[model samples]
Each structure stands twice: as C-alpha cells, then as structure tokens.
Target: MASIAEVKAQIEQAKQSSQQAMRAVQMLNNQLDQAIQQITAASQGTQHPKVQQSLVALQQAKQKASEVQASIAGGVRSATEYAAQL
Candidate 1:
C-alpha cells in the first residue's frame, strides 16, 4: 500500500541500521581479540585449564560476532539491491 519512494526510503533506513549493527559487532570482536591476546600473554608459562577455557570461549564469541556481522552486511547488500530496483 505504500508508494515506491516510501518503500525505498524504508529500505535505505534498514540498510543504514544494518551497517551500524555490523560496525558495532566488529568493534566488539576487536575488543574480544585484544582480551584474548592479553589473557594469552598473562598466562604464558602456565598451564591453567580455566584460562584455556576462557580463551576458547572468547575465540568462539569472536567467531560468532564475525558471523553476525557478515549476516548484517548481507542484509545491507540485499536491501541496497532491492532499493535500486525501485
């Protein structure tokens, strides 16, 4: 029921939001990477199971964030394509 212009505007808004989300996710991942590095450095020459687990957990979280960011980028691309067709 909406006009093409309105739909295009909505799509643009969604794309922008997706971009922002992607940036946020990327920032979080960077922080996670830094944390992982710090933990590794602090635990050098030590064999702590809990520290190992923490590193694994942080790595997994970073991976998941990367996946989420990729998904958001895909959505933004799709929205841009759809808007172009309008």
Candidate 2:
C-alpha cells in the first residue's frame, strides 16, 4: 500500500497532468477558432477548400472540447478529493 504522502504526490501529479491536457485542448481549440475566423473573412462567398476544411475543424473541435474539459475537471476533482481524504 502506498503511504499517504505518496498518494498525495500522485494526486498532485494527476492534477498537473490534467492541467497540461486542458492547456493543450485550449490551444488546439484556439487554433481551430482562428482558422474558422480567417477562412470566413477571406472566403468571399465562394466554396473555398480552406473554408470547408476550417468549418469541419470548427465542428469537430466544438464536439470534442466540451467532453475534454469535463473529463479533465472530473479527473482533477476526484484526485484532489481522494488525496484530501487520505
């Protein structure tokens, strides 16, 4: 069995990992947003390939970002609570 100190350390590590993952997701989402904005601005009402790709990226990111954030939050919360109880 792990000691309380070890468990607390692991919890901290898990929290850090979650934070890193959240930052990565945020960065990717920001990129997607920028791509969409730029594509939309320069599209000029044409069926441009870049605009289509950006729209798909925006859709995919919208679908996944919420799930990613919620999972990160839940994991971090669970780790912290478990450590606190130790």
In terms of lDDT, the best-performing candidate is 1
Regions of candidate 2 where Cα sits further than 4 Å from its true position: 47-57
State residue 63's C-alpha deviation in candidate 1, in Å: 0.7
Off by over 4 Å in 1: none
Q: How do the residues 5-48 of candidate 2 rate in per-residue lDDT, one tens digit apiece?
A: 98899889889989999999888878778877877888868897
Show the lowest summed lDDT stretch of 10 residues, model 1.
14-23
**Root-mean-square deviation of candidate 1:** 0.9
lDDT of 1 by residue, 1-86 (tens): 99999999888888888888888898898899899999999999988999999999999999899889888888888888888888
- All candidates' lDDT scores? 0.90, 0.85
Task: Give the best candidate by TM-score.
Answer: 1
TM-score of 1: 0.94
Q: TM-score per candidate, in order? A: 0.94, 0.82
Scored by Cα lDDT, where does model 2 land? Answer: 0.85
